[model samples]
Target chain A: MPLSTQSQAEEEQYVLVANLDNARNLSNILKAIGFKDHAIFTATPNGLKVTVEDSKCVQANAFIQADIFQKFTIKEDLVALQVNLTVLLDCLNIFGGSTVAGISTALRMCYRGYGYPLTLFLEEGGVVTVCKINTEEPEEPIDFDFCSSNVTNKVILQSESLKEAFSELDMTSEVLQITMSPSQPYFRLSTFGNSGSAHYDYSKDSDMMELFRCNETQTNRYKMSLLKPSTKALALSCKVSVRTDSRGFLSLQYLVRNDDGQICFVEFFCCPDVEVDEDL
Target chain B: MQCVVTGGNVKVLAKAVHSLSRIGDELYVEPQEDGLALRSVNSSRSAYACFLFAPLFFSRYSIDRGLDFRCKLAVKSVQTVFRSVATLEKTVEKCHVELDKAKDRLTFTLHCKHGLLKTHNLSYQDTESLQAVFDKDSCANVFRAQSRVLVETVVHFPPSVEEVTVAVSSERMWVRNHVEDEAERSKALLTELCLAADEFDHFAVGAPNSITFCLKELRGLLVFAESTGLPVSVYFHEPGSPVVFSVTDSVLEGNFVLATLSDDHNLQKSDSGGGHAEPPPPPPDDFMNDDIDSYLIAMDTSVVPGPSTAPPSAASRASPAADSRTRKHSEEEEEEERDGNEDPGRPPSKKFRSLFFGSVLPPSPQTSTQPVTTQEVLASDSEDEDE
Candidate 1:
């Protein structure tokens, strides 16, 4: 058989296969949600969803549509598996991962049914490397159930505005208190650190603010350590949507544009810290 | 104390700090009215680097009250603050360094052009100041070479070669890989390169000498020189002495000193051979043999403990007897003994005959003389049988 025909024959045995012209497209998006080593991958006919959780209080998910891949095939309705994201990244960038112009690593990922390892073939500049990473039983990710209908307060702003604030946030502060209200101090981010307390306030009518929907004033404090990883997603995003439910559950959705000018989304869900009574 | 460093000079300071951090975990910062000096010494004391930046290098230089203010800070902490020097150079307008004596912390405030301010407060430790003093005039050999040429030459050497021997004579300078073991030395291919004396801008040699030092540290210093685009000047007095590499730019000067391996004890001992009145050169035919004999003697006496464990060689069989006789000759009398062995057709030169004996014979004067005569007789008998 010819080379192409051989690979086509080999691809038939695998239950799922994904091919991308540039491996960095997948690697970069996976990095935005890579706060942990192991990532759960759930693939359906629609697309692929990768979820990573830490401390059971925070969860990050990256969604890559099936259409993003040049060649994506599935033998089953749904294929799920878990693998070490760090190892997968290393395999994807085996060719030194240089971002030089007109050079990229092409990737072909395959997975045979239950007990088989996930195989990756990366080729760059006429050189090829094949890596077989053992997969583990996938762990079911927790659902925050943060429905849009239950969102008490929501606001959409350009990521550039929030990026500045997040970069300058005092890391010494244990928790970051966010207050969204229709009254004065429309959107406020407060931190009490060792040096001093700092407050970054933005008016509702600011040019950076794209959308604002507030039914009631809600104040929630999330652990700074848990929210810190979202900054990675924020740095690559153009727009961000901030939402809080009545139970003080916070959700941040970031719209990221890749090198090809294609749109992707990375969302983060974080549970608020224990509320302290103020009427004492 | 407060001072501000602006413009492209901030990158120079950051690079200096990053380089110093590689030498030691803690950096000693000395602030004088003129400029600042940063110093670090490795744990093994084999390597030391010092960077001196003059006052003219900084845009705004000041001293609070004292003429000299010294403090020790963690290298990692300082490196973390200036991790993004490239970005800082473009956006940052000025960097203000303030020493808060009352608070026992040092604060670095970065003022950006867009009114963005970032502050970092680092804790320091109380440590004694480091002072490295070396006299360049006392060194016997000194040479100045272009950093690019030196770095390009050193890069060709194999990484497995740990120490490199640098031999400088009146005619030329040569660098070769230094092998420690005799057996391995013979098996391994030797890599040596020679450069004409004219290749160096300034070359001076009082005496012909060869010194072996760690190659890895020398490469590091050469890299620093290459980055700064400065000529590297090397100074060395003799074998086993520390070699100093110095580089100077318009704003800063750096000196790196590395210790050399000691290989001159046996050579010195042989030269001083037993208070002899006269030292005569050996005959031409025996010249190669004498060199091998002396090397074997030195290897036996200085490094090896016993002849039984010596490398399997024809000359090693006679080492035990030679070792005992050589022990009697003091350093002061070594020259006389070495000359006494050089007399043509002497019994001492017949030491090569003992290699035929498989067993260790008793040390007897007659037995020592018998082996040479028996070897001659055996040769004649073999000739007769052939006839």
Candidate 2:
């Protein structure tokens, strides 16, 4: 139709373009890391990374590889811009976000370099809506600098097992204490709530645990409020990788598979609430 | 009063309590030998819901020695305890409800399998009974339709629609969103649905009638009706009367009373005028077109138990043609005054006073001094003045 022809003619002026047959593929992942309003979008030839941070202590990143998109094109080496993630998601799913099979909203996202609004064209059935959301100067996202080599302890477990414990975690607790060791009490999640202290232990040899590598015992406490938003990613993921570095910086990596079975990754990095006394 | 409910019956009770909680914060529970009655009225007094569960619906029903056991409990407390009825249906063996009259608290004890018991004590307040008495024979129109059809049709209308106008005649019954904004009216695109007389289980119309009522409350009542998988019976006298929606199965009967909107005919008239020319003259004797004094009387008698004593004053005041004409003229003047105060392109101001009163004008003067019959003379007076 005329709309398709017009989009083709208008696509040449943009530095970056991405298209998805199902807009939910993008909206769902954005919702996973949607802990804050402003999201710093950094796009490269490899893929797209959306970063959201809270209080500079917790940072979340959602990675969508280039192959996941039906069509991904970039004329520049790097493109970065910041926009309201909530509004962007709302615009992406403007067609009521129906999950019925055989019905999907097609999306064509275009960004014209510097000072221009991030333009999105969403169409379902025959109706088309074009939304131009104003972009802001991208803020520098905090670098948690949590490297695998510096990781002192790591464990990968099935998301289903952790989901049960997360769902029942007492919110009255100020902090969630994680203890990983080579000896007994192998992996533990402890919460001291108003009612009482609760400990959820997972044996290192359990079927749900995929990998467990601990050289020495490590105990770290993370603010419950900071780690609460990661539950969204956990709920959508099939497996999760929990890692703690020497400095006690915690990282949670979730492997999420969308409706089409295409794989994506969402990572959350949270700073420890307190430095543990080694004597304990 | 003490009762035990189990299985699917508890789920139904929970749904009813949840629906009543939407109407009012406080729910009045009245237990009688026949059954139990749950009633609530909205704070605005614009909407009311009454649910009656027959004794057969409960597994074991008993009442303390008294005329009737009545108490008011906070709706939120009840709703929280019964939030997940589906879970209760599977896990709960039986639920026993007891009214501790001495302590002024109602206790609910739930017994589950494996000897698990949970009890919730809900404090209640001392409140007067809620009684809405309306003569069913006085209603001129009655129709019964499947709840599914009504709910599916209402879904087509936009969410902004506050009121819906239902027009029923011998031929067919149709509903249309009552849009009051001039700008929205200009679009000429409205959600309208019509159902043939055959679609209704029973359709009887003494006279062609049109009524307007709030759509939000109707939607809520329709949800309750659909949950029961029963047809809804609607009864109304005329335009400015309370529209009653009744749903009844073998075990339960629910009646939802919503006050029809006044001055809705004015909205239709102005809409048809296409925003050009002044509104057509108000219907001469439509009780709503009367002076504020008589209008208040008409409103008051519809709710309170004073229909016999209140109508004489309305009839006497409505007798003088000169006074009625002046009042009608002044009402029109006041409407224009309101119109002038609003933004030019805005639709006519809403009849907030009439809406707040929720008064239904008695259909005929023979029923209540035949107050409307005098409007014919008043119409002629205004026509002469116009010439």
Candidate 3:
């Protein structure tokens, strides 16, 4: 049947508006609500054209209810997490199809609208040099929470080269630590655990618990604290999920360990040209 | 730099079979250039021979006078054999001079009693894009000749001969003069190929031109024949075995040697018969240079016995016997004495020696006109290996 003629009773169209970085996450959430394999196309400006099966028409609207948006908080451990430019540089340095041409092409196609005046720090021969984003400037700097409280979060290996990468980390049987200040945070993580490491101890006395909005429900306030990881414990394997907070910050939350383990987060904001719904 | 005479001067090497009857009814010419072409000619009707028409005048010291460069391109016989000789008949006489220097040229046409036979154009280029090599400064001169001649050649059948001894010769003077050194050239080629050949088995691909295993198999067959002096007949059914060359009717008839060749070689057989079939593209000629040199090592064990058959003329038999007896007796005596002197740990029996020595039939003194000289032996072995 031609899609246009299909009755709203038969199928529904969902317009998903989010930063492209969170496209896959929203897609999955929509899928879980019976919106399986919807025909998805790039939306005009900053939206995704999603066509749901008639069966999912009810489930999708209910899943994207206003309350879910209220529950969402794009949380970044804004202070604890730092955008170590080296990780992006290292990711870029990988040869093969990963040449500068590929990076530049990817930047032009994917990164241009997201940000600009994007300060890049490069270390060459042990000297730190700064690079400014050459293409159009990003509408605003990336918004992140920069809270450094979570001291013990799981190290994740989420790439095709995961096993090989972590074998190189040699992080097992060792106390891990990480420290970050609120001024700048949000590490543009490498696909694998291959690139960076962090270790820290979360003292019981420190502000150990904080409520963070998880995108799924307003009542789903994610609490954060840290526990000392057993040196004898092998690193836990985990999956990642991206959620937008009430404040409209896109946080990459590692839904990591199955039982609501620590959430290591990064925050990204949509391009300013994207007009947020005034009603929110 | 002082010029030293290489101490060896150009000598008449192999003589051309004077008449077509003296050679095979069909002679296959393999030029390094355009693969191989077998030309069929009527032996009784056409007189065939190459004459060296050059160096018409010779000074004991330097440049010879009256030398016919055109005649030097001629084919001739090395022996006073009784046969029909091709004679140069009609000549296009022309001479030119540039700045008072002599440039002489001649064209001769030949005729045979019967009709025309095939002539091959075998020029090849050294480059991938094969173009003729040219001396840009030299004037373009054309020397055209009709190739045919008649001679009443008599076949003097030796009394005890079981097979006809057809005389054959190379058209190229270069091949003739260097036949003795052919093995050396082949050997050098083989050495460079050893590693590549040895590693052939490691490659996943089927054998196309596997240098190593091919050499080993050829060597094995040759060694078996040489060890026993009994002709080694083989029926190779293996798909990978190279069975492109055949020398004796015995090998061809005794077994399925034809079946042993790669499918391509069989295709070549049919292609060979079709007169219009273009020559099979040759393996790179330079490649042959390397292959031949390395293969020369096997030459000692594999030279095909030349035109030797049962019946022998008294004179023809005499010289070969004298040469073989002198050479063989000395070599055997030395080998025997050395056996005694060798350490006991050395393989005590000569059985192993038979593996190599016996397969190579000592040149049959009674029938073979030429002595199996070391050089000739090496050349034959190399050729067999190369093929």
Candidate 4:
């Protein structure tokens, strides 16, 4: 795999199209999903194009989405989650009528959101060092086998016995090292666990990871923030139970303490890898 | 005229003159040379199919309210007339007239070419008078009745839809005669119905029996299923019917869907689509009341079965066997009419006689036996003396 230079990263761009009434509505919706301060772009009659600094984009989007299921309206909760996932699936329905395009390109964007938080460093030979990503369930230590070259582009992890490790803040200070392809100076983080071992995967030549439908089901959860009403980081305390449905289906349920001492429940089942629209 | 193919039913030709009239307006009929041709202007192909198939394939459109009303009118008229004869028979028997061994003679004749609308004025007493007219037709010479009976009935539809009332009545009569037998009467009634159908093929009323509403909530949900990249279940049920349609996510529940019927609020009023007009006063009550009088007269005459009940000496001997069978059948019919009339002598007093036909003039109790008195008796003879 050859590394991408600063010049190469500058040239790459991605286009995003949404049916939102306006950019403000789009910003609000994205912000609810933990996105903030990202550049906002308006769609022209033609389309909207987005340019991003690889490291910054990967870092901002890389946050562990342990709670992605919260994005749906109660009435259309399941449908919303399913659509979000389907959009990520190599734009499955994207090029429905076109037969000429290879299915692989469509397959690549599926799990791209999983890899983020890549390490960034400049090199004189037009090469840059980008960080590797590790995805994991709170109960499982990062498994090295996930990054094996022989493994297929999509992988599913499961556990017979699973339990939540201590919260990330409660753990001893330590940094986990991940390896990228020797030729590429950068690697992207696919996904992360708020607590416990992280998982990593390597692509042959680019920072982009082949899209795959991935999910982690966590249970017995609680969230609390120590900061004041204006500024507070959400604190989650719950037992983690993880599993993935290969057919792009996910079922995750969480328990959190409310103002009352009683535990409240939240359930999530994601149908990821949804077919995307090609006319986007 | 050339025939135009509409769908499966071919339209033979476009009709120039619309003959059938309901109220003031002429009801348009498909020219008999061709079949009927009526279509909605604003609808698409699917809407057209829904309208066409509604009455035939689905039982939703089957009742035919108008025809049902017609049937009720026919049944009531015939039954009341039959009962009137039975009453007259008992009355004659009490009097011990002792005219013939067979029975007291009676005969009944109806001019039903006008169909159910002819009964718009008919009632028990009116029917009795009408029967006297028939009896005169049967034996005016032997009975010493010089005057012939005339029971003329006409069903008048209101000029405007707002006027719900109709008028009916009969003319002059003296004696009651022959009664129609039951099976024969029913067949006659059916024949009249056929005639009415002929009239109705051209009658086009503007209002629809029921309105349909479409479910718009299901629109975005169709695309939502595609997000899963898997099949989602769908359920659909139509209005006014119990049928349900369902499919998996791969197939759409209403894709090949026939759209729901569209309705116009303005359609409820008359086709003129103008604000409702002031209703006209109801048709003359004599129209329907007179018809009822004819029915009663018929019943009174038919109640007594005898040789005199035969059509006439010449015609009776010509068809003696048939006349005897008819007489025997009339006897059975009297029993049935009695059972039916037992429940509601109120049928004579129902508001529809006044509402749809005309305001039925309540018969003066004095005329119950005679049904109708001579106009000369009611008029002063002083004018004759002056002449």
Candidate 5:
């Protein structure tokens, strides 16, 4: 409440500022895509977006819509800055991120523009702490150019099913092959590990499958290590949409519901692993 | 060979594979007339375990007659297929295991809920089944203790403890960990526990003896026993012979054989700080005197008394525990008296090897402290062949 009482002139100095009654709302979603260290933060009037990339082969984006925050303001048309995700998470959870019901940490995040540090004021149980994380030049995120119209195969399933499938995925396998088709063997996940090959299939009419649309059957292979981190998002989400473009690029969008029952989105885009026998 | 485990038994099969994985890197699966046998032997060849799954354990079972079906597969490969036993129990309805001779591979198919079918095909190598020759019925010392008793005692030992000595007498039994060599004493963490002989369901001690074995295999046994809520039956001879632990049910039986260490006896007479050349009690009645081949315990006196007086004590062990006791008692009555005075556990009435208790730092009484009795034989002998 004290943060909101700050003089309007002082608040105007910050090009971007947002406040939430519960810091976990921001910290939890950030954690969904916190697998990488350097995260590019883009603040626009719509909300805040955090993007993390790995080996230029995979990209993860976490979006926090404007309405979710208790107070949101943006003086600039677009503000992009990069910061260490691990450090930011540590500062946000400095109070240990109490999970007790009705106990929440108040967070006020502010950025003064380029060449300035991102300041965070966190309060828990009436005790206030401040943190200033230095920002670095933002790097452009790779655009997989995987649009909705180009999607050849798509399936929506409850998180429970995918969670079981992913948790048991063979880590020894170098790549995971996914087959999505309209007819027989509707959707399948296969892995070729040291011991042998394993396959898990899902019929279209299964109770867990919420939606299934396939214009053409597509089989693509993705690096297991690249897609492994997305299990964190899958664990927190309630529903997930899996799609593959005609180019064999993969996209996984998770509908994550935060602790406050507010909906948020985290999406992952990964380029397929090329087989040795396949001509370039 | 082909077998089908309908619903109920799939979980048991998975757990058996998991237990075999802990024993060795390779799994030897043998198909026989009566059932299927899964076996594994540690790389050091010191520990070997086998599980026999009867035909009743599987709903549908068949194997070609007069043909060898013994094949070895990487334990990890098969273990991966059965990973997550808890999940498998709930989702899987039936599991089929079939051997494909043409393809030279083994396939595991699981039919689960919601029309979901999962299949795994593992390639295996043809090999001879490793069989350990030991008579479980003739073991001198045998006892059946509840898994709870073993687990409670093992929990007191820190993970750093690699070996544990099981010392048993007619009246009492004890467990301890600490190598007696002075060089290893600084790093050796001392732990001792005394378990009453009555704690077991059945207890028998033909000869008061001590056997030191690795905890790694014991842990593997505990995993199987605790899960099935079955007591583990231990049968072993003297310190040098292999110890066999068995768990059984109406449909399944598992046997684990672990090699006992002989150097623990050597670790005894080699005591550095006992001050007196404690050749142990002159009488061999209470101490472990192996009539069988166990020269290490009998040969270590030379290494210990190398710089000290009484170099002949090294050659004394060559005479066996019985013959050596008479020789030592006559040769060093005075030294044995000093050892009896320093150690409260080692009474002259019992000729047991107090090799370890003699060096035991005054029982500090740990929160879970169990005393290292003179009769305990400091079973903490570590396996020299652990490598």
Candidate 6:
């Protein structure tokens, strides 16, 4: 269904419009970045980007390209608004076909100018549920400026492999240490938990490693609590790219495949937790 | 002390761990001369479940011969390693577990299909095993069937059902939600299923008997049995006796013993006993935990709706020979003897209530106590006074 088919009189009132045959394709990817309640929705001609931040330390951005949806339209050049992501997700799954097949909830999302509620038109099995979630003032997201040129070490691995590591991670540990080197242990994840210190090392030549590029031996620690939310994205992704900048800032890009087989991306940028005194 | 379970057995071990987690918060991992013993008892101490994975069950099994090896880890922590059995069966090639004396921690390392290794080091403390004593051979009423039959049957009953009654005569076995009395006949949601004795693979009833036991632990055991592709066998005597559900796989054996109600205990609170007296105190709660047993002994006798006053089955505490015979099952486990269990036998004599409870009867010395007959013991166990 396209916006042209709907009442143009009513559509003219909305500054932003997006439509999907199945709400799950949009909601599933949104759930990956929904660790927090507040989400900033940024719309451009290219696509819709949803950003969620935690404590100003970790920020997750999910990019849903304009092509992933059946109809994507924006009256203005840049339309940005903030709303409770948890509420949006609940509305998306209101029809409850997130997992079931043959029953899909068609979603039509619309937004007016500032301060207007974000209206959702969801239909499943001929029944419709309209949810109007209130919107809030959009806040500026932090910019890490972590470009590829500044990335000291980067590794792209099959999410299947990283999912195993993250699922079994010792949650008791306050921080997760990542080590990447050109020498012996090519990649490692270490945690010092209540029981003891456990390290998982993945050799550079391992089959699960899609690409491994390391120039210097770099080790950095990130708060496990901040990095933990990325596990949800890792579980839904097919491949995950892990990169650490020279300043110990970490960037994770997950390639998530929607139910329609279209490609989407969810990325996380995290600042270092602590620098241990290990000169000895 | 360490053991390695490889190939398909890893999933079985994980399944065993998952099953034990359902029973208790803590798991007692004891390595015996026979095999590895994992046991758990519920909080109220009404149900006890054990899995004895024989040496053959593991690809590599070894223990420190000189030092005593007994430690307990939180079941929740151990479960994180074996979170999903269906997935573990596919991705996990082998699971190596170790208890390093120097480290003093229980470590489980799972080697996955992609040469991925995940290790979980869980802190554990040295603890005593919770052992339950129940006589399966002496139980005149026995029922055996495929695991799915019971699993499917259990699904029909609502989850709120706390106690379930299985009544057996020579011909029929009636399984129904335990109804306290005729007054609740209309308002209560009752579900009943009747299976002929002949329907079971093996069924025998030497004497007419009915046992009302907690249904939570039984459902857990049945699901475990059904998943492991093993048949379940049930054996028990009259009410108040611990009903044992035994599942034996190729190299693994599990016994789930549940507490049952005696049906005859008349409540004095006049509250309609409306709450339906909490079955019986776990027969095994006495010897399983010393604190609970002694506390039970310390409780006022009349406050508890004792199993019975002078109905029948009461074994004498004076006979040691009968004691050994009744404890023949758990004797191999060598469960440490606890206080007040002078002679623990349920042989229906003056010994009364000794099977499920240690006899601390007859507060006969204290005049401050009520003047009731000595037939009723404290907490769930009742004995018949000498006629």
lDDT of 5 by residue, B41-69 (tens): 65434567888999998998999886766
- Kindly report which residue stretches of model 4 are placed more than 4 angstroms away from their true locations once superposed: A1-26, A29-280, B1-50, B53-277, B282-387
Estimated TM-score for each candidate: 0.57, 0.49, 0.15, 0.14, 0.78, 0.73
TM-score winner: 5
Q: Using lDDT, give the best candidate's number.
A: 5
lDDT of 5 by residue, A113-223 (tens): 999999999988888888999999999988899899999999999988888789878888899898899987789898888777888888888888999998777778999
lDDT of 1 by residue, A64-105 (tens): 999888878888999999999999888887898788978988
Name model 6 segments beyond 4 Å from true: A5-28, A37-50, A64-139, A164-174, A177-205, A215-219, A276-280, B266-387
The sequence of per-residue lDDT tens digits that candidate 6 reaches over residues A185-268 is 788888887656667778788899999999898889999999999999999999999999899899999999988899999999
Candidate 6 lDDT at A214 equals 91
* lDDT by residue (tens digit), candidate 2, B295-322: 2212221222211233323322221235
* lDDT (tens digit, per residue) of candidate 1 on B1-387: 676888776766776777777666677776766577777654433456778888787776777753345667777667655766556577667777777777667777666543345556666654333544355556778899999878877987888877777777766777877765556765976787787888888899865677666676677677667766789898976554457788887788888766565434213322222221221222122223353232122111111112223222322222222221232222312342344345463322222211112111122222221232210111100011111
Order of quality (lDDT) = 5, 6, 2, 1, 3, 4
Model 3 bad stretches (over 4 Å): A1-116, A135-237, A240-280, B1-387
TM-score of chain A as modeled in candidate 6: 0.96
Q: State in Å the error of residue B136, model 1.
A: 1.4
- For model 5, what is the error of residue A213's alpha carbon versus the real structure, in angstroms, after optimal superposition? 2.6
Model 3: lDDT of residue A275: 30
- Per-residue lDDT for A185-217 in model 4, tens only? 122111112222222222332112222222221
What share of the reference contacts is kept in model 2?
A: 0.00
Pick out the ten consecutive residues of candidate 5 chain A with the lowest summed lDDT. A271-280
lDDT of each: 0.68, 0.72, 0.20, 0.19, 0.74, 0.72
Candidate 2 C-alpha error for residue A119, in Å? 32
lDDT of 1 at B80: 59
Give the local distance difference test score of model 5: 0.74
List, residue by residue over B50-143, the lDDT tens digit for candidate 3.
1111222111112223321101111111111111112112110111101101312111111111121111111111111001111111211111
Candidate 2 wrong stretches, greater than 4 Å: A1-280, B67-69, B85-93, B109-118, B181-184, B263-387
